[model samples]
Target: MKTLLETLGFLALVQGAMGLLHEFTDWHVGLVQRVGLLDGHEVYASVALIVLAIALFAAAERCEAD
Candidate 1:
């Protein structure tokens, strides 16, 4: 379970980085513009990634404690 959590956390971090890049470059603008939801997608993904990373770090600490 700990390993799984770590993996998920890593994935989330990577995804968040990508999302940020997209936002910076307006890479996803075309898609979001079509759907009319581009204004806040990056912020949401970034927050989610940060939460996932924190959760994984906490899980890792717990595993080490055990």
Candidate 2:
């Protein structure tokens, strides 16, 4: 469970950062922009992802080691 949370948190952080990066610069990377549903909501999604990552990290920190 700890390892899973950490992995998910790391992935979320990366994807969120990538989304924001793609939005600000000409790098044009990440799945956020490619989603048809997101459209102009890429930034929001990115921010949400970052928030999720933070929460996941917190949860992982609280988890007991097996």
- The candidate maximizing TM-score is 2
Angstrom error of the Cα, residue 19, model 2: value is: 0.2
Candidate 2: count the clashes.
0
Deviation from native of the Cα of residue 33 in model 2, angstroms: 0.6
Clashing pairs in 1: none
The models' CA-based lDDT, in order, is 0.68, 0.94
Superpose all Cα atoms of candidate 1 onto the true structure and report the RMSD in Å to 1 decimal: 4.1
Query: What digit string (tens of lDDT, one per residue) describes model 1 on residues 25-49?
Result: 8676322234345555656756667
State the lDDT of candidate 2 residue by residue for 1-66, as single tens digits. Answer: 999999999999999999999999958888899999999999999999999999999999989642
Poorly placed runs, candidate 2 (over 4 Å): none
